[model samples]
Target: MMQTVQKRRTAGFLLVISGASLWGIGGTVSQYIFEIHHLPVEWLVAVRLLLSGLLLLTISLMLGNKEKVTGIWKQKKSAGAVVIFGLFGMLAVQYTYMASIESGNAAVATLLQYLAPVFILAYLLAVRHTYWNMRDAGAVLMGLAGTFLLLTNGELAGLSVPTEAVVWGLLSGVALAFYTLYAGPLLAAWGSMNVIGWAMTVGGAAVSFLHAPWNAAWGSWTWSMAGSVIFVVIFGTMIAFWFYLESLKYLKPQETSILGCLEPLAAILASVWWLHVPFGLYQSVGTCLILGMVIYLSLPQKQRAKPAPA
Candidate 1:
């Protein structure tokens, strides 16, 4: 039994790292597609959501979640929640991250999005869901200092990244906070696969009307572009999400979330090495601080680690 449990834990660790790293690489590939091939961000978003959603739903069926696959739509409140999550939460997160990448490098974009936990903590305090504590305050301060340094290179003269990129990156962080909190109830109700599948499908369908995924004429359609898009949709979206949800079954939420730092690190490395994006000393320190905030927040307080429902 002990050996079995140990093996599961190992699997969970590997899964989290793999999933997060894939997401980081996906962002870089998306940047390449956008910058080099001039693909429309909206088109990519719409198609990615739609295709990934369908694939997830199919996986749910294969896993004997047939009941959950169809049960979500039968209720009024859940149905409503799914739709709202799809649009405002999932879609918002996806769109803003892509927009930030288009406006700036993937490293900065991803590190900024890691500010989600900071936003989540702030929201908890604002709503009186969590009480003020010194540790929480410290984490908040760390995140702020990191952001300041990252944006202005530790000097208040100006921003190292574009203003538009910063705006979209910050928005992505906010959307991620919303996504995490809003997803709790849905995951509790219908399982992660079911909830995510439906949310992505709904979000994708909504985006399709606005962006029209069928139109690829706006961008240069090369074999590389096609391959990049396929990679983003398949391995990045579907496999990454699957690994995340599966890891939850074997590891505590805190463990998986802390390990998620791998995502941004992968993005930073890929950006600098592959894309030749700048990463100066100040920015490096700032990256460490932001990542430290994520690690600190993931640590257990007075309470024990909570198991994620998924």
Candidate 2:
């Protein structure tokens, strides 16, 4: 039994790492699709959400989870929660992330999104009146300091990237926090696949109505574009979510969140290697500070205080 538990923990760690890496590299792949293929951002987002959602739902059905998928909507509260999550949390995260990547490269966009933890910590302290912990405080300071270095790069003259990218990136972080907070109860009630699948489907359908996927010019589609899209849909969105959620069975959410730091590292590496995006000295140090803080927060606290009851 002890050995089995150890194996499960190991599997969970591997799963989370693999999932985060896929998402990180997937962002780079998305950058290629946008820059090289010049695919419309709206169209790509719509199709990706829809296709990934359907694929997840199909997988759940194969695993004899069709009842969970179909039954989620039968309850009024669950259905309403799904709609809100779909329209607000899911749509917000997707749109803001794509918009950030559109204005900047994937590396900056992803790192900015990681700032969600800081935002979440702040909200918990200020709004929720949660007790302040020194570790979380340190994490917030490090995250902010790192973000400052990354954006300004010690240049007092002007911002590194366009102001537009910064705005979208910040918004992406906030939306991610919202997504994490909003999805908790739903995930408990209906499992990750069911919640995510329905949310993605609803969000994607809403975007599709506006973007009109059919209107996208098919002449632009090439082998490279096809490959990128397939990878993003399958490996990036579907498999990544699957592994990350599956890891929850063995690892605590906090551990998984810490392991997620691998995402920014993977994104930065992909940006540097594949896209040849420039990385400066100060920016590297800044990223290290942020990652270190993340690791710090990930460490087990001997007597961590319990969160206040909602």
Candidate 3:
């Protein structure tokens, strides 16, 4: 019994780490696609969401979740929730992230999106769903301090990256926070794949209507570019989510989130090595502060608290 439990825990850690790493490197692959192929953000986002969603739904159906795959839309409340999540949460997160990358490099974009925790804390505080606490304050401070360093490098005279990138990146973080918070109940009720599959399909379909997949003018795909796109859709979006969610069976959500820090770390490394993006000392410190504060905030609070493990 003890050995089996240990193996499950180990498997969980590996799954989360693998999922996160795939997501991290996926950003770098996207950066390459944008730089080399000049793929439009709208086209890429549309293709990714739609294809990944379909693949997930296909898997769910094969796994005997056919009922769930079709049943989620039978009720108005559930269907409505899926629509909201798909449009505002999933679509926003996906679109803003790609936009951020287009405006800036992958490293900054990934780090900024990591600020979702701070946004979630603020939202909870605003609604009185959670009270103010030192830990929350620390998270906010760390996020602010980190953003300053990452963008300004402590000069404060002007941003190191384009102003537009910052705006998109911040929006990405907000959307991520909303996605994380809004999907909890639905995911619990409908199962992760079933709910997210439909959400992705809905978000994809909405975007498809605006920027139809058949109409995509994403640059001519070379062999390498094709491989990269495939990796982004298959490993990054679909399998990454699967592994991350699957880890939940063995590891606490908090533990998975903490381990999920590997995503940004992987992105940063890939950005620096693969893309030749600069990562100076101050920016490095900022990244640490941001990621550390995130990990800290993920910790179970000393006092009783609402939301998360705390």
**Best prediction by lDDT:** 1
lDDT of 2 by residue, 103-186 (tens): 888988988988887888888877755668777778888998899888888687988877888899999999998998889999
Could you give candidate 3's per-residue lDDT for residues 1-310 as a string of tens digits? 9999999999999999999999999888898889888878887888899999999999999999988888888989999999999999999999999889888988899899999998998888898788887767878898899989999887768998888889999999999999999999999889999988888888888888767777755465578888988999999889998899899999998999999999999999999998898888889989999999889988886765666653
Question: Who is ahead in TM-score, 1 or 2?
Answer: 1
Question: What's the CA error at residue 84 for candidate 1, in Å?
Answer: 0.5
lDDT of 1 by residue, 1-310 (tens): 9999999999999999999999999899889888998877888899999999999999999989998899888999999999999999999999999999999988999999999998998898787677777898899999999998888887678999999999999999999999999989999989998889888899889888878998768454678878999999998888999998899999999999999899999999988999998888899999999999999988887853434446
Model 3 local distance difference test score: 0.90
The per-model lDDT (C-alpha) reads: 0.91, 0.87, 0.90
Which stretch of 10 consecutive residues in model 3 shows the poorest summed lDDT?
301-310
For residue 177, model 1's alpha carbon misses the true position, in angstroms, by: 0.9
lDDT at position 13, candidate 3: 96
Off by over 4 Å in 1: 218-220, 303-310
The local lDDT score (0 to 100) that residue 126 gets in candidate 2 is 76
| TM-score between model 2 and native | 0.94
TM per candidate:
0.95, 0.94, 0.96
Say which prediction, candidate 1 or candidate 2, comes out ahead on lDDT: 1
